[model samples]
Target: MAFRLTPQDTSFFSLFATSAGLLVDATRELTRLLEVQPSERNAVAERLRTLEHECDEATHELINKVNSSFITPFDREDIHNLAANLDDCMDHIEETADLIVLYRIGEFPSGMAEQFEILSRMSEITAEAMPRLRGLKDLPAYWIEINRLENQADKLHRKMLAELFNNSTDDAVHVIKMKGIIDGFENAADSFEKVAHTIEGIAVKES
Candidate 1:
């Protein structure tokens, strides 16, 4: 293991883990929303809103901790960026759910279910990577898997857009609404990769 310049307030790792766990929960909620009754989606979206707020709080705590502590587990900038990226991921997840509820989107397109599955896998991989930050062990696998998932998401994203624009019979307004939701999912996946990139950088620097 590489030397970790941690403080007594090593709670940053715990906070990071908690934030990632919230992200996992949020993704699961989205998966459920995709499968459940249309009428039940709004309530599921509300749960996502609550989870997002909690994630925001966790990110804020990480920021405050970074500000107060003279020593951090990694570079202060890396910590802040990682925290922000995690929060951004959760934000996009929440926004996707919100749009579904707000737009009264009837059925989640079958293509989007695949996107949600990718998001869930990304979130799970990220949560697993969070604790590994303390030791910087076996992290290459984490980032590699994240990159693979992001690529899969990109392929799905392109297919969804192609299907929506070319073959769908839905009205322009409805297609536009779905485009926004798809954008959110794509953005969320990108954010996870960003976090992975940040961790990869920090690990290289620390090593």
Candidate 2:
């Protein structure tokens, strides 16, 4: 039998997919922010801020639809959780970019490139998966890859922390700045994993 969604659910899926695309844009901006001049960082962050705002609006629309709809494509609770989780991912992505500008961090740690790389990959995986939620077909690969990336991110995060505290002779001030930036990156990675988990749960129940 084919899967079917009420028209409202289809609209929700479309909005969710749009938010996922925004996340991809945010991740790309983050990577670009890492490579650019310090003076240009603020401008890049501003663009991310705009994307984040759009994601926020999409999330609100999803929640409002859930509240108003008498029937949902999947479990209403799952729908709510998925929407919130996706927004959380976007929140962390925006926070990572905003903090970079606020802290005026000078050097990008070697480990940071790896973290953002994983984030970029996760965003692509997530953007792809959101639309697939409609049919719940062949989605195991999406969540599985996200889980693997989350594990990879954890290892890199630990390595970054070890380098941050162990090898640096910098003053307490520098440590504080770098720590904030690294924490943001770690949070973003963690949030992406949460998104994957929520999607997997929905897929499992539907299948």
Candidate 3:
């Protein structure tokens, strides 16, 4: 049987997906902003502020939805965890963007784009995982693939951090900047894993 979303759940999740989509767009925008000429640094900084506000508002609304609803499509704990995980993702992204703006980072690193690319893919995967909550029992197969993405994310995060520490100069600025970037990407991966964990929890209950 096809699982359906309640009107409330549908509204809540639509906002969730929308926020994730905005995060992807913001990531790309930040990438482009960093590539621009030094003279335009102020504009990129302003854009970061705007994106941060949007992310914060979206996250808070999602939390409110989780709190106010007496009934959820899944377990209350699962829903609460899901909301927190999603917020964590946005939090990391926004934090990193602010760091970039504060530093007025004029030059783009070569491999940073690749991490963002993987993160975007993972974001879409997480969104796909959300609607499946309503139909958890029907989709045992999904858990495997979702878990696969989580593994990929973990591997990529480790590799990226290793490269960051290995190849980058020993300057404190470089270390801090690279670590911030790596942490944001890694945390996004962790956020996706949290979603998987919620689904797994639901699966366990059903079984």
lDDT at position 172, candidate 2: 92
Q: Candidates sorted by lDDT, descending order? A: 1, 2, 3
lDDT per prediction?
0.91, 0.87, 0.66
Quote the RMSD, in angstroms, for model 3: 3.8
lDDT of 1 by residue, 1-207 (tens): 465445546699999999999999999998898678888988999999999999999999999999999878878999899999999999999998899989999877758888989999999999998888887889999999999999999999998998889988998999999999888899999999999999999889879
TM-scores of the candidates in the order shown: 0.96, 0.95, 0.74
C-alpha RMSD values across all candidates: 1.4, 1.7, 3.8
Clash list (residue pairs), candidate 1: none
Question: Where in model 1 is the C-alpha error above 4 Å?
Answer: 1-8
> Please, what are the lDDT tens digits per residue for candidate 3 over residues 70-169?
7666566666676667667766766775666677565555556766666666666666665655555555555576577668777777777787677877
- TM-score head-to-head 1 vs 3, winner: 1
Query: How high is the lDDT of residue 129 in model 2?
Result: 86
Q: Count the backbone clashes (under 3 Å) in each candidate.
A: 0, 0, 0
lDDT of 2 at 168: 92
What is the Å distance of residue 55 in model 1 from its true position?
Answer: 0.4
